[model samples]
Target: MCGIVAATAQRDVAPLLIAGLKALEYRGYDSAGLAVLDGGQIRRVRAKGKVREMEALYRADPFPGGTGIAHTRWATHGVPNEANAHPHVAGRVAIVHNGIIENYADLRARLQAGGRAFTSETDTEVIAALVDERLAAGLDLREAVLAVVRELEGAYAIAVIDRNAPGRVVGARRGAPLLVGLGIGENFLGSDAQALVQVTHRVIYLAEDDVVEITRESVRIHTLDGTPVERPVHESELSADAVERGEYRHYMQKEIFEQPRAVADTLEARLGPHGVLPNIFGAGGDELLAKVRGLHIVACGTSYHAGLVAKYWIEEYAHLPVGVEVASEYRYRDAVVPPDTLFVAISQSGETADTLAAMRESKRRGYLGTLAICNVPESSVVREADLRLMTRAGPEIGVASTKAFTTQLAALALLALQLAHQRGLDADRYAGLCAQLAHLPRAIEDALALEPAIVALAERFIPRQHALFLGRGVQYPVALEGALKLKEISYIHAEAYPAGELKHGPLALVDESMPVVAVAPGGPLLEKLKSNLQEVRARGGELIVFAEGEAGMDGNPARGALLRVASGGDFIAPAVFTVPLQLLAYHVAVLRGTDVDQPRNLAKSVTVE
Candidate 1:
């Protein structure tokens, strides 16, 4: 479940639908398709690969369809092929769906028993058949969707268009994200605001269990029980330029370079003469964070790595214990949570299925309050949270997530610093930490300056099949993030372990052929990390170290790739160190001719668990 775009407008919405699909391409899809109710009938076009292919197919012989729906599919229920591509049609109805229909197998059997043949193996097709069956029973489009959805179980967002009802689209979301874009003589539906940015800025964020029916002039929403409701129309801050790749070779590279500005945007208003303002999180935010005794940070992928780094910052600065967990695992198995613990959920999209579920579960598990550190303002996690701190990284169109990661660190750093001040930590030390954080934007800028060196390092990784990353203390999470970037974009197998853990078990795999990347930011653990690097050197492992220029690599022996970055001190070191690793991954992927922005087998947002 990845992306969906639905629109009914005065003009031909085929191009609009296709553009929306292309805009969501960063979410990673193996197939794409669109269905338009053209000329009093439904016409379908599906492609087995990128949206560009489908656009090419559509444009080869364009048609005037004033109403249409489209989707970019990240395969879950079936193989990646045209047959399984979205806009699944049954009878006169066509639909595009995101999220799992958990009871699809049973539904499919039930439908098959009724002698209805299925066209696709997707759970979505079963949904289409049910809706079609309801319509066949003389139910209207809205009633048909409501009846079918009531019989279904699991998280889902669906957009259905019927050939009999032109210039209208019916959408419902129970768990996944779906929204409506409002415009004169046009209205829109999208999984994310970015999808509708090209069409309109005004959007109505559909809440859980909300069903919406949109015509060219009006939008009517109802609950699954058919109770009428009204959703707020938010003027999205996302500009068309924010989602475009300008000057940079790819969105990933653009986002990597944008980190300096991104981090600055996140930290600017929050930090003042007094320190981090409590209001930056939300209104009355201080009440939520003030009495926190501990934190239970939950996230997935890159966000999880950020949480790992935050554990160190909070414990070091605020003198508070922190527990970090993978969101998917945390919700499934929980033992105990101490009193006065703040539940923190961090995500770029703020719509991660696991993280959202974990945060919801934590509410019942007794936490002080829930805070969402997210990039998207209108995302579900932010809306459902007791407090929210926006990263202000703008729109991160890259699937690999460069600016979003750094900006999240910047936000987390602010939280840690604010908590430190609240706890009456040393005045001078707190000020120093604030200064380091303020200098983070420039530090990230300096780090991006090392791209030429990272490019040279990238050449070394071109032929390598595997790599290793090492760090100590807070940098261990940076190491983990570095490993993730290399593996995700370059498709090289990479692993990260604390430098001290080399001898424990991981060192057995190190050899002359293995490239070991060491994140050697200047800190108290530098000496210990140096010793660990020597262990790799003695074993003939190719040593690649990213260190601060002040961290004397001249005296330290372990070497291969010694790249120096601007030192932001340990307080903001994680954000600075992340830049070069991101660039290295980008260049390495470019050299290998791999997709950098839309990495294979990965989506920009994990909407499905």
Candidate 2:
């Protein structure tokens, strides 16, 4: 369940729907399809891979309907095949859904027992069946959706069109994101603003339990219980140009190169000449920091790696004890929330299912308050959290996050600096950290300049099956992130270990067959890290070392590979080092002929558990 696009227009909406689905393609999907209510029947086109296939299919035999629903599905209940794709139809209804339907088995059994036949093996198909059953029971399209949603259990955002009704679309959201796009004598619905960016910039972000019906001329909203409601319309600043991959070969590469500008955008105005302005987290942010004695940062995937780095920064500078945990695991355990401990959830989309659940669980467990560090300003996490820090990463369409990860680091750094100042960090030291934040953009730009070297280095990783990454202290997380980048894009099996923990069973796997990539930055632990690299070299392991501006390797090893990242002291090296790693993965994937932007078996955001 990944992307959805539907529209009711005065003109032929097939091209508009196709364009919307194409815009959401970066979210990652294995199958794509769209169904238009043509004349009195549903016309369908389904393809197993890219949206181009379906678009071509539609071009050969066009169905000129003013209303349609489209989907790019990342298979949940079935395999990635055309038969399992969305725009699933049943009786009078055709639907596209994004999110899991937990009670589908129960509903499928009940429907089958009642003589309703099933086709595809998707939970989304069950939804189509349910909505069709309600429609057949004499309810209108909107009523059918409201009734079907109440009977359903699980997270979902569904858009439906009745074969009997023209110029209309019914949409409902319980967990996943859904919004209505307003236009002149036309309206649209999609999973996110990016999908609607081509046709409209104004939208209504649907709240949980919101059911909306949009036609060419009007929009109506209500709850599952039939109570009428009004949702605010938000004018989106997102543009179609932001998602285009201008000069880069792939979205992953483009986003990797965008880190410098993205980080600068994140830190813009958030830092003053002296230090962090503190109010960047929103109004009353300073008072919120004053009460915080500790932090519990919860996130997942690359965001979890960012949280780990933030723990190092906040503890080292603010003197605050920080506990970082993966969001999926944080809620499963009986947490011990210490007094004045702020619960922080970080996400690029800010709609990660596990992180949101953990944040909710934290409230019941009694934390000081919740803070959301997110990229999307209107996401659920930002709307629900007591405080917020928006990471201005723009739209990170690639599944293997590049600029988003670095921007999260940039945002978390500001959070750390603000807290450090509250702990009475020295003026000179504090100003130095601020100065480093200001220099991060140039440092990243320098790292991006290493692309040719990284491109040459990619040839080495293409033939490799596995990799080992190493770092020490703050850079340990950097190593983990580097390993993640390689494994994500190149599909190379990789692992990371603190340079201090190489002998703790990881050393046994080191050999000439396995390359060891190390983030060897100049710091107090540089000597220790160098010794660790020596151990890998002794084991005959090929070494790829990213040193800090020629400082870590004075007498360079003739047998090893070395690339330098522009250093900006110790405060912002993590974000800087991340650039080459992203470039490394992108180039490796390109050489290996892999899907660099939409990696296999991965989506941009984890909206489902």
TM-score of 1: 0.98
- lDDT value, residue 24 of candidate 2: 87
Q: What is the lDDT of candidate 1?
A: 0.90
Q: Give the alpha carbon lDDT tens digit for every residue of 1-609 in model 1.
A: 479999999899999999899899877579999999988899999999899999899889888888999999898999999999989999999999999999999999988899989878899999999999999999999999999999889888899999999998999998799999999999999999999998899999999989999999999999989999998889998899998898989998988888889899998878987688758878878877888999999999999999999999999989999999999999889648999999999999988999999988988998989999999888899999999999999988888878889999999999998888889999999989998989899988888888887888799899999999998999999999999999999999999999999999999999988999999988789988888988988888888888875343454354476877767787888888888889898899999999887888888788888
lDDT of 2 by residue, 492-565 (tens): 99999999999889999988889889997788999888788878888888888999644344445655588977
lDDT of 1 at 255: 85
- True-vs-predicted CA distance for residue 93, candidate 2, Å: 0.6
Off by over 4 Å in 2: 549-558
- Collision count for each candidate, in order: 0, 0
Local lDDT at 299 for model 1: 97
